[model samples]
Each structure stands twice: as structure tokens, then as C-alpha cells.
Target: MEVYLIRHTQVAVDKSICYGQSDVPLAETFARDALALEQKLKQQINDLHSAKILSSPALRCKQLAEYLGQEIEYHPDLLELNFGQWEMQAWKDLPPEEVNPWMEDFVHLRPPGGENFVELQARTARVFDALPQLEQSPVVIIAHAGVIRSMICKAIGLPLSNAFQIEIDYGSVSKLVCRWGLWNVKFLNL
Candidate 1:
């Protein structure tokens, strides 16, 4: 099975604000980026109709998915890291030590009111399990940076703490092919 992953375009929220799972508006200049990304995907996928497109339920992701000119299957499981109470707060505004706990032990450290990568990975596992049933179908999953990172770690058997190692930028594409119970990472953070 072939899976194509891409992150959503930039949101209007300032960089100081944490926006995981937050429904923030996209940047006003998204048309250019969206068009470029769509063209890039078209180049990658000779027959765009051959790939099934899916996206996170977040507004940013939903809007970007529409640029593909197909009905995207919006899945709640595709949402970004649920930052809980830290959704819109700046790092400096958060408690001193708690802010970086996730960097140390991401799997167990839960954000004030949100979940850690552990929870994110668990949900991703469910999505991964279901993908096998759709073997031979190339699927395009437009999600968040964090979700894509988690999926990469899960695919490569990297420790959860290493999720930060993968760099998935907005509108970037990555490809994965799973065959015979083995995962082949064709592209990452493209």
C-alpha cells in the first residue's frame, strides 16, 4: 500500500501561539502556496484520480484539502496534537518546567489539558491498522506536522522521544509504502 502524507499550510496564528488542534484561520496568501503544492502533487501523481485524499478535521487542513479538487474524507483521528489548555498560549506564558516535559518524555507527559504524543500515536496506530484493508490503493493524507511526525516514528520504529527528529513542513509531501508487514519509507518531510 502507498500512503502520501502532507502538512497543512500556515495559519494566521502568530508563531508565539501554540495551535495544535486549534481551529485557526489560514494565511491570506495561501492561494499561491496551495497552487504550488497542488501542482507538485499533480506531478507526483500522474493520474490524480488514482489517489484517495484524506485530511484532518481542522479548518486549516480542511481548506487546504479542498485545493486538491476532490472530496476529502475528514477524519477526527487526523487532528494535530491536542494541546489542551495550551492551545493558544505562548510558551513563555506557560508554567516554566511543564512546557518542555514533552520534549523529554513525550509519550507520558500530558499537556495541561491535552494529550502527549502517546495519545497521538495510539490514535495513529488505529488509523494505520485500518489502512491494510485498503491495500494497493494510494492514499493522500493531509494532516498536521505533529501527526506526520508521529506516523514517521511509528513507521520507522523510532522511540517516541525521537518524534522531534522528523521535520514536516506545511504543504510538504512524504510517501510510504507498506508491503508484507514491512514499511518502506519512500519519502519523509518532503
Candidate 2:
């Protein structure tokens, strides 16, 4: 099985804002970025026309998936980590006291009214577990950074605590291959 993970294009929100699962708009450069990604993806993946395309239900991801002109299967499980009360708030503006605990142990610490990194990994894992059963190879999943990171972690047998070490930039693509029940990362942040 060949899996391609694509992060959504840049969001319209400011850099300091935390908009996880907040349904934000795509940036003005979406069309240009999408076109470039499409071209690059075509060059990288053979049989692109027959590959199965999946995406998060979030508008940011949906926009890019649609722009790619593929029939997209939207999955809510592919959404970014739920930031809860931090959604749409600037990270710098968040209460340091409230943020400290999560920062100290993000993998296990649930933010105030939010899910922990472990929860995010579980949902992403579920989505990945179903991929091999799908009737397609070179499966493309368009989703958020967190979702892609979690998938990479799961693929490489890396602990969720080290997820931040994998950089999933907006509009970037990562590839993975599964064979005989073992996973191998092809490349990342392409």
C-alpha cells in the first residue's frame, strides 16, 4: 500500500492564532499553491488518476482537495487536534498557567476543554488502520498538520511524544508504503 499525506494550504488566520478544528478559510494563494502541489504530485506518484483521495471535513482541507479535481472522501476523523477553548485565540494571548501543563507533557496532558496528543493519535490511527483495506494503492489523504504528523508517527513506530520532530508544512506531501504489514516512510514534507 502506498499512502500519500497532504497538508492543507495555508489558512487565512494570523500566524499567532491557534485555529485547530476551527474551520478557517484558505489563504489568498490557495489556487497557486494547489496548482503547484498538483503538478508535483503528478510527477511523484504513478497512476495518480486512479488513486483514492480522502480529506478532512474541515473547509481548509476540503478546498484544496476539491481544487485538486479528485473525488474526495471526507472524514471527520482527519481533523486537526481539537484545541477547544484555544480555537481562534492567539497562542501568545493564552494564559501561561493554563498552557504550562500541556507544554510540560503534551502527550498526556489534555488542555482545558481540549483533547490530548494521545487522543489525536488514536483517531488518526483508526483512519490509517482502514487504509490498507481500501480498494486502491497510492491513497492520498488531505488533512491538517497534526493529522499528518500523527500518521507519520504511526507509520515509523515513533512515539507520539516526538511527533513535533516531524515537520508537516502547509501544502506539503509525505509518502509512506506498507508491505506485508510493515510500514516504510518514502519521504516527508515534499
Candidate 3:
């Protein structure tokens, strides 16, 4: 099975805002970005037209999934990591005391009323576990950078602590292949 993990396009939020799991809107360049992404996918995947599309329920992801003109299935597991009270808060304005602990141990530390990376990893693992049963061919998942990075980590057998090492830029696509329970990364941040 081949999986195409796509991150959402630029969001409408301010640059420093922490908007995990928030239903943010896409930027004005959505149409242009979506078109470029669609063309890129067509060029990379031969059977893109027949691929199954799954997306997070967040508007940022749904907009692109809809724009792609495919029958998309929404999955809550695909949502970005919940930032809880930190939602919409400017990252630079957050107190160092409040943010430092999480920065020191992000994989295990949960924000005030938010989930940690371990929880995000668990949910994303479930999504990957179900993929083989859901489809035999290519599968495209439109989701957040966190979710895409989590998938990449799982596919490549990297530790959750190294999640940040895999950069999933907005509107970027990463490809993974699974064969008989073994996983391999086809490409990253394409």
C-alpha cells in the first residue's frame, strides 16, 4: 500500500499563533495552492485519480480535500494535536515557564488541557493500522503538519522524540510504502 500524506495549505492565522486542532481557514491562495498540489500529485502518482482520499475534519484540511474533487472520508484521528488553552495564543507571548517544560519533553508533556505527542502518535497509529484493511492501492490523507509528521515517524521507525526532525511543510506531500508489514519512506516533504 502506498500512502500520500499531504499537509494543509497556508492558514489564515497570524504567524506566531498556536492553532492546533483549531478549525482555521485557508489563506487566499487556496485555489492556486490546491491547483499546484493537484498537478504535482498527478505527476508523482500514476493512479492518483483512483486513490482514496481521507482528511481531517478541520476546515484547513477539508477545503483542500474538497477542492481535489474526490469523495473524501473524514477521520477525527487525522486532527492536529490539540493545543487546548493554547489555541490561538501567540507562541512568542506564551510564558517560558508554561512552555519550557513541554519543550524539554514534548513527547510526554501535555499542555494545560491539551494532549501530548504520545496521544497524537497513538491516534495516528490507529489510522495507519486501519489503512491496509481500508484500501489496497494508493491512499491520500489531507491533514495537519503534526499528523503528517507522526505518520512519517511511524512509517520510518523513528522515535517520537525525533518527530520534529521530519519537517512537513504546508501543502507538501510525503509518500510511504508498506509491504507485508514492513514500511519504507518513498520521499519526504515533496
List, residue by residue over 8-119, the lDDT tens digit for candidate 2: 9888899999878899988999889999899879988866778889999999989888887568889999999998899889999999998988888889987678899999
Task: Choose 1 or 3, whichever is better by TM-score.
Answer: 3
Clashes per prediction? 0, 0, 0
TM-score of each: 0.94, 0.97, 0.96
Candidate 1 vs candidate 3: the lDDT winner is: 3
- In model 1, which regions exceed 4 Å deviation? none
The stretch of ten residues in a row with the least summed lDDT in candidate 1 is 128-137
Per-residue C-alpha lDDT of model 3 across residues 81-144, encoded as one tens digit per residue: 9988889999998888989999999899998899999999999889888888974478999998
Better of 1 and 2 by TM-score: 2
Q: Clashing pairs in model 2? A: none
Candidate lDDT (C-alpha), each: 0.84, 0.89, 0.89
Compared with the true structure, the alpha-carbon lDDT of candidate 2 equals 0.89
Give the poorly placed runs of model 2, Cα more than 4 Å off: none
